[model samples]
Target: MDQCITEVKPIKGFYKLSMKQRMGFGAGDLAQNLIYQTVSMYLLIFYTNVYGISAASAGIMFLIVRIVDVIWDPVVGAFVDKNSPRMGKYRSYLLLGGIPLTGFAILCFWNGFSGSLTYAYITYIGLSMLYTLVNVPYGALNASLTRDTDEVTKLTSTRMFMANIGGLAVGYGVPLVVKYFSPDGKINSKDSAEAWFVTMLIYALVGLVLLFFCFSQTKERVIMDEKDTENVKVSDLWQEFKHNRPLRILAFFFITAFSMMAIGNSAGSYYMIYNVNAPDMLPYFMALGSIPAFIFMPLIPAIKRAIGKKQMFYVFLGIAILGMIMLYVISTNEALKGNTWLVLSAQFIKSTGVIVATGYMWALVPEVISYGEYKTGKRISGIVNALTGIFYKAGMALGGIVPGLVLAYVAFDKDNVATQSDMAEKGILWLVAVIPAILLLLAMYVISKYELDDATIDKINREIESRVNY
Candidate 1:
């Protein structure tokens, strides 16, 4: 073991990152979320209401695509680990995969093949698969950068902050842009296909630019040696999962946290358009979902220092539940529903908790990776990230499935734009509030099972580095 460890060298300045590198590293996530958040939040609505697809069909398609991800993620993970492309091991995909990702993303919103499930299947599946190619590598890139727990924490905060900027842009900007281009000046109108296409095209182009920037700015300093790379296998993904307890805990947490966020996000449009009876307020409400990240995310390092990690999760998760309860109460009450201030206030409160809880989870990824390396004596960031990706995508699948199923079950009439049935409105409300609240509760429980605290992970990282140095 000592002889094996002696072959590798400790990375110099592993914990230090310049602000430019941090910001540039973050831009990749920002770019991804700009396109992905739009799909997560609006694609279902677009499919059922505007693009002329059945809710049930779209729901099944979502599940199928994510199931595909379960298989594809491991393949991508193993492939990425084995190959070191000329551009960079992980960064190459940022451009290679990103270009196609942008094109498919734009095509997903186009209505040229109106009401065609084949068109939806072709474009949506393409977008999802290409996304994996980029995402798995991007996730691995985080652990590749450094092993310092504090640096990873700070890096994660910046990444989440930038990611939410994309979320904010998608949440608020998409609607506003689509509305501006719409002939009727309304996003919900069936005739707004042209508007959706144009908006997505611009967003996709911008996302490609940011991805290129991310590729240029980031470097991978702490990575597996070529010999270690040669040993990586797809089956190692499961092998690591079996032995890595923290990864399991974190993976489950991903499922629950992402499910909560996804369900709430998917339900936002219906909540604003139907429950609040204020389409104009949708942008504000959606934008507020991400805006809290700007204020709270930067304070994460301090917040963790003060409260400790688990307590932070407990506090924020509780706040999220409270906000959801408030939203449910206000929306159900006819008089209170019309008051946009109250609704927006509830949104801000809910988002603060959701954003902070979920945002901080990314920081835990490196800890788990370090833990895995400490135990297994192998650093396979790709496989570990692939496992997390599977679970998060599983969570996202629920986000897609639940809303579509609820809309179908409630018998939502796409034709009735003026007002949905009472049952449908209640279902949308449940999706926005009650469902997410339950998921938040589950998330809190799952996070509690995560055993690695900063002190523990810091020790593990040092031990791992010592081995490499000796």
Candidate 2:
């Protein structure tokens, strides 16, 4: 069975990773997600409520930043592939880009220039750019570590496990910790500015420490040669997008998948605080997003073996859609809306589907990169990551815009603390339920086109190994 993997003999290019080695690689994602998940889950609310801006304005800033990411991600990718630092190829950025990433991440939550769109633009853009610096290279790092497909599945599982730990920390912990520091113990309010800043500061520091540990533990073995590295170009990203069919399919999947995630996550605080009218339950609701990861992630190998990857995705994605439908039905009825267990149960199911489906997608990245190498004789991991990054941000762009537009259309009032109008509540529900469900459906169709089966990918990896050891 594929799930029950044992250590294999070291092939020319393929090799097994130890537990510490797996954890060390996984730590990079965990470190990044501390800031990434926090920003995704909270920054929009922070902008509207704590930073004293309209939801529409915050949404505009998110759109602009992601647009900038489209250009910036490729540059970082090309740059990384073009040069190798003495520190390491991909691992060097864990420190180089990470320190600045932490500073900007903390700054993004600061309210010193509250309601100043200029200040918001500067800090938020800075944070997004630096995030790309770390993210693009770290993606390359995953493929650079080993060529063993089973090892990558295990590595991705560990990475997602730790990534969800950061998600849990940010999801529940950000609010709970902010509440501890918050004036009147309220998280999303104009007066909670200081609390948001302090909470981010703590998370960012911990992230930096983990990046250091990752830098120490990760080594780059599977990479392009020094000669090949010199020729990597931004245009190569476009070339790969055109020529690599698997990359194209995965790229589109990224857009749809991330859009669904962003929309739901962005709308969650409002759903709980406004729709459910349970501000106290915000942390618990958000924590459900990551709790499923712990329960399900360890079982991934077996799950993949049992049903195969595509079927696993179909099953989970459907479960998520079912969860959303349940949320819509329950929340619409006055009697059922008051049922806390029902609301949380629906959230848990929805989160389980989303977490498992999206988390495992990382394993495909290395496969595509290997495919690219087999076809072109050059492994441009950064360029492929940048292409995926673009689509991922494209999804994020939709994620950023849709919520703001929906809220604006429904006339959501940041000032109205007690409750929103009927239409506004429905808008939040659409964000949490209806819209994301539709996108999940689209993601399902997009992923259905993926042609790489496990056997095909393994044969390709072996062929590449036989030709070039690197």
Candidate 3:
């Protein structure tokens, strides 16, 4: 491992990365979203309808996995910060963990152990833990790339763009692929177990190839000293969270933002299938969630320059809320309920806001890391990401918990393929629209508390670099 750690002189001026480097960095995220987004969006539905688990049971499992993450995330973070593999400081895990992550991800969708909670627990938990091993390091790798705020912003934009591409693939592609492979040519049918398993296997392998591409392309430029790494500990994660105000604000914002996305994503298939009575249109509806990112993410740096970060959040989040309202209104009206175009239009509007707002928040992660380093003279990127990961997973837990519980509460009948009860449809609507909108409202408030503007973050980054150079 030591032989693989390349020693480079300390960087002084702005480290402008090549387009290839930026794209390479972004590919890691794209890979992750390819596999993880499928899990986030479709896993619950799989567990319930296809895997024969009760919604309530799946919901409880989701919560338990998050609790495990609460413990596991910090461990991975601290270990990664404290140890540098030969491949790279943080980038090494793209392979080390990525391999197992791919395997577990594939195993997760396997119905070989049909209706077995233990199989679900083992595969899901393994996948989650391995994801942390890869994700925490990948996040730290971002901060380790360069200190230039503008460069980070550009990098983030590219990353989000690629991530949305992955989302698009999963959103539209998964159902298409699954349905194509389904014995009866219906994706949502209970008999499509083999299709789900095969689809996940293909997706997971593709993800592994992408991860390897990311690993081959990325190189860590800025990193902590070996001596400093020795000081890293799991407890330092909590300590940093306690003192880092910007991190705290960002962490809380992560909770709300991810919760909004998770709830909406998890409910999307149900929304189209049950609420809108358009099972065939489910792919288009879900794909719209990623379409806006491509259209708007390229303009992020300019958008931030025009309106400022806080105002950007306010405007986009408001747009998202409006779209959610539109969705709810149209879905409930007898006249508009079955209008596919109107529904797609609403999804487009809502996703446009969501893509920009949540997409841009990632740029802030590096900013907060710089702020922490400025204040404490330590850049524990791994630990910081872990803290944020915990909160975001907390949000994801809600995504799992809320939908399953709501479905169970509404007595959603998985056995009834023809139509859901009115109560079940309403619950699905709440998951897709009302609940997520409320979470977005809270996200708006939480982001309002973030204090690290670009100028402030730049100053902090410069100061930290000067200290490193001295």
Instruction: Give the true-structure RMSD of model 2.
Output: 3.5
Q: Report the C-alpha lDDT of model 1 over 220-322, residue by residue, as the tens digit.
A: 8888777877879999999999999899999999999988988999999988998888999999999999999999999999999999999999999999999
Best TM-score goes to which candidate?
2
Clashing pairs in 2: none
- Per-residue lDDT tens digits for candidate 3, residues 1-470, read 45677778545735888899999999999999988899988998899888899999999999999999999999999999999889988999999999999999999999999899999999999999999999999999998888888898899999999999999999999999999999887776678999999999998898899999999888787787878878899999888998999999999999999989988998898888878888889899989999999889999999999999999999999999999999999999999989999999999999999999999999999988888888888888999999999999998888879899999999999877668989999999999999999999999999988888888887777777777851
lDDT of each: 0.91, 0.92, 0.91
TM-score of each: 0.97, 0.97, 0.97
Model 3 residue runs over 4 Å out of place are 1-13
What are the per-model numbers of colliding residue pairs?
Answer: 0, 0, 1
Error of model 1, residue 235, in angstroms: 0.9
Number of clashes found in candidate 2: 0
lDDT of 2 by residue, 193-278 (tens): 99989999999999999999999989899987889779788999988888999999999999999999999998999999999999
